[model samples]
Target: MDPFHTYTALSHQELGDRLFQGELIIFSIADELAPFLNRTKQLINKHFGIPDPQKAHLALDEPTYAARASETMTAFERDPEIKSLFFSALETCGVNREENFYDRLVLRIVPCVTSYDKGRQASVKHHRDTWGSNIDSQINWWLPIFPLRKARSIALYPDYWNKKVANTTSDWSFSRYLAEKKATPSGEKIAYPSSPQALESIDEQACFTPELQPGEILTFASAHLHGSKFNLTDKFRFSVEIRTVNIHDVKHGKGAPNVDNAGNVPMYQWFKQIKDDKKLVL
Candidate 1:
């Protein structure tokens, strides 16, 4: 059965059990999330110099829009309050913010055009995050800064949970991509990212697209094959995502199955202890 299982709350760490089983969990809007959204929207709007971020593309050209979006996203990541609000929301949803380790807060503003897909566009393609990081014990938490529709939301390919799909994980490197990026001129768009990508077509796969509202949390295993939905709505979509790893899960090697991943890098170093911002040194 291709029947999908989605829950409304995450009250504890038993989440590892459900997530590794390929279940998707959705947490309702919480008091902590509201403040984060407010602050995020404020920063986004400020960076783009627009009152409504949905129409940000209309106000500026594609290149300008991308620069502004990058500025906003970078600013959001550097802001102290945004990080605090992020961890606070996690705590409200049963995550022990003080006990686990977390990666960086990734702010994504997706426009309708592909030319603007500069840095963080790889995840919008079909592939499990573990295909790149090689760490399956991480939990991916997504928050839509704006309301989502069919065209602007994300799609998870549940049918391929245990199936093998050809991918480019065996031939991708972030360091090489950066070196080539430096060789390119400043204003020109560099070559496409060499991140993990699906080599086979998944056009006929059974997919699940959940329409989420603002201030909601979409939590799932990092190994779930997911991608951005079609952009027929023509409106820009903004969202935030962060990954956390339970120290216990790490020590025990607990996570989803590695169906076809070819990556070998242990991405544990990017994570920092929640209790004390100490890096998870190898």
Candidate 2:
């Protein structure tokens, strides 16, 4: 089967089967999420005192932009209202959030005003999410905070579904990386290692989608090869992503093994038992 598949609509069961089969699923939830995303943008602009958060990236240096973005994200994540709205949105989309295990969701704010700016480095290079602490069975969910055109959206390399790429995971230490990231000053983003990897040479065949609106989501397994495409547009690209794993799948060994060694420890230190809210050690 092809690795990428787009759906106009899907039931909860269909979404689960497709995800477990390692296929990419794109579907809509726009009506349910637009208002929440709008509020989030307003909060960011208010926090930065900028009329347009997208253009603000052009005026500030990389570190300053990262700091301000981080501050806004921190405030947004800590807000109880935002969390409630997000979970509600997920439930409305047929996701049983109560039955899944997920760490905190993340907001990604990319401010790139030009093609020549170093801010392009902020865009992710081709890699699998499993290279992080994510388990192989984890399903990643992403949605743009604003409407995203094809040129500005992320691209996936479907041909590499079962192929290997030269990466620096052999020399990387997940535990050390986590500790260093924690030690870094607040409001700063940590830079990953810049060693050359095979992904740098495989861009010609990547697949980019049509414009993805605020209410839609794109999901794929941890092993999917994906990365950011250069933002040719003048505005900043903002998005949110979260990863979830079904404990039953994990316990039954129903998904791929963690051969990539993405991290020394599982991302969530403890998985919340849906029935009783007990902490299950990973």
- What TM-score fits each model? 0.90, 0.82
Clashing pairs for predicted structure model 2, backbone only:
30-215
Worst 10 residues of 1 by lDDT: 114-123
Compared with the true structure, model 1 gives a TM-score of: 0.90
Cα lDDT of all candidates, in order? 0.78, 0.66
Backbone clashes in each candidate structure, one number apiece?
Answer: 0, 1
Please report the candidate that would top TM-score against the real structure. 1
Q: Tell me the lDDT of model 1 at 219.
A: 87
List all candidate RMSDs to the true structure.
Answer: 2.4, 3.7
Q: On residues 1-282, what C-alpha lDDT tens digit does candidate 2 reach at each position? A: 344566656665577677766677776777778677877878778776777777766577666766677688788878867766776677665667555776557777655554323321256777777776456667778888877877788778766777667666656666666676677665444554432234347755556554778888888776777777777777887888777777766666555444444345555553454334466554
Model 1: per-residue Cα lDDT over 1-282, one tens digit each: 534444545655578888888888888855668999999989988898977778766678776776777688789989988888878877877777555898888898777666655554322678788887788888888879888896788888888989899998888887787787888654455575545889998954587877888867888898888887756676788888888888778788899999998888877887998767898764
